[model samples]
Target: MTASAALTVIQASTLTLDDTQPRVEAVLVGGGRVLARGSREEVAALAPRARVLDHRDLILTPGLAEAHIHLVAYGFSLSQLNLHGARSVTEVQAKVAQRALQTPPGTWIRGGGFLLSELGLGGYPSAALLDEVSPHHPVLLYSRDLHLSWANSLALRLAGITEATADPQGGKIVHPLGTLLEGASELVTRVMPVPGEAEYLAAAQAGADDLAARGYVSAHTMAFEAPEAPRALQTLAARGELPLRIWACLPHERLAHARELGLALNPGGLFQWGGVKFFADGALGSRTAWLHAPGFADGSGTGMPLDPPDLIRERGAEALRLGLTPVTHAIGDRANHEVLNAYDALRPLAAERGVRLRIEHAQHLDPKDLPRFQGLTVSVQPIHLQADGAMIRELLPHLAKTSYAFRSLKAAGAILAFGSDAPVAPPEYRATFAAALTRRDDEGQPLAPGEALTEEEILWAHTRGPALAAGWADEGIIRPGARAAFTLWDRIGGHAQALVL
Candidate 1:
């Protein structure tokens, strides 16, 4: 569309989220940018020959942005056996058994999204539980939080993880033969079937399209999967087949290679390399969240620390120098604390480079450390709160008061970017809205009720926060010269759909 061409005016109860003029009745678009936004009559008059779409009952806002997700993994997960809401061990086995029946006897069966707590298990589940159902097929099911994996005997034997197997650094192997925590899970995963380039491309396309259908115009894909994952996304973007804009990260291990290839942060594309990702600790669900002092109330130890502070400080400095944001995953309080320490040291370099230091998951933090998040980006997942609420209460009751502290982090001057760590939880915007606005868990209990945000705050976090995190000035807002990407909702964050010019 040319600038001289007649504009397309979208009429709705437009919540622009623009501070100067927060609400407008209509938005005029031309050349994929917001040309004008005002009252229906005003905007209509500005674009007299414009094609008008009238939906005054619906609410239109800036397009939603998924702040953190594993795009390729989520796409692959779409085809995997879903164990998301399986409430019992029997239920989990039944699903696995059903999947096994459809497959050849000896094929590996990979699935995830079940919590040990939800399974009513007092401790880590044994392979015997799964062996009883599918002794022939190799099975590996991950915990809801993706921090732990449960493997059946066949899968274990394939990986050569016998009773004598030693735990890898920064990981654990739960005895009695099934669970692998942190790095230890890689043992079985390393031997599993690797998706070829074609599979990777398909998964990337599936993930992007899925998010677009869910009203997301863009996503910041955190690097947890193999480098092939981003390569596939890049291929999709180059072919113009990717439906959503993707801001991806390079795993810290590849930072040297990225720098060698002169991979500076590139903005303004369907896909861009935006950050360098690191893991400071494990997750909460697997009882692997790194905590301080008394650790897990149940005496499960203070979780596991993955990347060391010195390594983060050194490598993070290199990432900042290369124009990539240092995105650290710090879910537990201790992890957050140590990461903050590293960020504190690297703050000067980050400021000098004009890159925001980002912390992913910051799930549980001490109140004293919360202030340190000021002037940084805290990319968090509110949807996880629904499932982690009960776990937080039981495992870290002392820190429950500040867990998933969205409102607090925002108040502390931290930019809060909301996302669904999909496959861990579906990228359902309603669940994100419900969890943030209501501060309620799945058990009908409120978790740190004070951390609840207003509908507007939630919307801003879902939109503007992510744009800022990715350093995209033109996205996540509806204004002059901004990208013409939008989401229309029946109510603010109710049922929604994407509209890209």
Candidate 2:
């Protein structure tokens, strides 16, 4: 297309997200890069022979980048049992029982997207609830957070988990043998059938297509899914079928292997390995996000911490030396505090290497640590506030004032990158924009109105901030020499479509 196409001009009300020239009337594109951007007459004179596509009524901005997602898994989830809005166990049972009849008797049933708190459970759910419906089929269901799993009796038995089975490190097996938290879910996942190369490729395509359809021109694929997931994505890029550019991570557990393979940060491509992903703790919905004292007002205790802080400190330095950003996931206050401490130690090295330290989810935080984010990339999902707001009130009321603090983070000098963390939530930018602008949850209740961001700030976070985090300078803006990838919106925060040159 680049070789055959003539230089083209797009005339739109464009939000460039460029401080020096924030708005432009026209942009000239050729060979997949911006040639010039300015008033229509000025740019048109420069490319008088260029084809023109007018969009005076729409708003065009830098193409969106989904800053965090499990690409392949979210793709497969589009075909799995979705318990997203199941209000009760009965509702969930009906879905599972129906699937059971369709599936083989001994087959494993897999799906997720129900919050334990939302399920009206006093504690962990029991296998009996599922056994009543699918006594023949082994069933494994995950809570919305993916940090907890509810397994039926047969599923538990298949994994050889019983009352005698001890909890695994970084995870827990709830009493009565039905619920597994954190790393314990691996017991069942490891036993489940693995997808072959063909399945992986298909899942990868499904995810990339869905995001592209949602108006994303790029995405940061967080590495928590199977290793085959990234491989499938890379395969898509190599085949030139990938719809969007990708900035991906490798699980910290694979750090040693990556070092041995000589894998390091390699930027500028349709896909690139950019960071080493580490989980410092679990999620709030699962009651496993490591918190400070008196955690979870409901007496769930301080949430479970995942990786050791020391590991992050030590290996993080190693990661920086190898040119890979050390990306740590820290949802709770304690988790963020600890990761920040580890990051502090890595700051000098990070500065030396010109790589930014990144923290994902920075959801709940201690006010004192706010300033520490000055030079770091804080990847957050405002969409999560739709549900987590209510949970925070019930579970961590003390944080209600500071939670989802987009405005505060910005003031503290952090580069705020927004994303959906799809499957956990949809990559619906409308929902994300609404949550950020209104500071409201699903119930239409305000979370922290003071933390709300303006439409321009929201656009920057969704576009330019992600590009900065991924170390891509030619993206997330409309300017000379920038990539000709953009999103056309009917309104500031509404229906959108991708337009990649």
Candidate 3:
């Protein structure tokens, strides 16, 4: 008996993409594998009992994948009151005050998505500002970029973070204002109540369901959440309730524990540990994007560097030794340059291990360093282009041409994996498709019209590129031996609906 001979069959008018783009026929899927794909008659002859799923006139392509996202954080963010488009400080304060009244006292209210530049404020918001609205309850509002966090005085006192507190390495406290940057955000978080197992599972299920509804069948989850996040996914998968396949990552700090637990790169199951995530620098919106030569267009100094290059290179090798892929966040030109340098040093090791090193948000690249990303996966968020467009024009106008340079990076031989750095930018694939293809921002500003990608390219980047980035050979494709996963839609670029045949 053939291995795939026992599975079900799904037939369509146009079976799109099997070793090539769009073809007519049927696919036999059994044991979660595409046993065979060919003309309807050919496949039907093999699995007569394989219940047929018909999408006669619909396009059947590989399932979509999100190359970069924070799973648990995105899930938790869904429950929090979002402040993503708040125009001014007063608006943010008002929103917090409203939530504060609804939430019980001292509930540790949290919400994100306020742009420093959009607020018409010159500097970052301070504890004093938030204290005005949420003096009784602890409030922590993260900047739109998720790089800087503003906490109320009550939250600071609870975390015992005083002015005299020393800045953690690669993090800073914004002077008398008392805002925490990067690693410093952890101090306040360490004191927050850790969610129980129930919250974790609920968030995971909710997060996964939301993505599935958006037509994403898979995602590469960047690690920033408690380990319970992946554990929750595993629970769902075990119960046959997982909505989408997941590739989970670990922070470099967790490598020791992973090794102690004897976990290696097992690329099966709905959830798999695929890479070790690192932050090479802060974010652009937070004014912490590490840049080279000329800094922000504004008078502020160049962005802050997060993880030292040498540290990344050293720890990256350690991760490679244990069969883990190295993924780093590099937003600014300088940050991208530093990560490229480190990756160059470790390329041989990564190649020997058959692992691909990825740099998240190769958002801005130095003209000189643009070629360095060749052959590397550039995981970028097109939706962020909507918000960062104005900032790019104002802060680094000279480099604006290459900012979120999707076409340039792809032309340079870089694999472009599109995603929404959810919570930083929400996971709206349709918006990503529209922004990348149109190259227009919310204000209809043409940030870089020349950098726009074609609709076909955008689709590939959203689907195949991300699967390749996660090293999932069997996903994001429709072919024999590939995962029997797909997404159905009313139209190609129209409404998306999950097809779980």
Decide which is better by lDDT, 2 or 3.
2
TM-score of 3: 0.95
What tens digits encode model 2's per-residue C-alpha lDDT throughout 55-93? 988998999889999889899999899999788999999
User: What TM-score against the true fold does each predicted structure earn?
Assistant: 0.98, 0.98, 0.95
Sorted by TM-score, highest first, which candidate order results?
A: 2, 1, 3
Alpha carbon lDDT of each predicted model = 0.91, 0.92, 0.84
Better of 1 and 3 by lDDT: 1
lDDT of 3 by residue, 367-387 (tens): 788888888888999999998
Among residues 3 or more apart in sequence or in different chains, the pairs in candidate 3 whose N, CA or C atoms overlap within 3 Å are 7-30, 16-22, 17-22
Name the 10 consecutive residues with the lowest summed lDDT in model 3: 13-22
Model 2, residue 17: C-alpha shift (Å) = 0.8
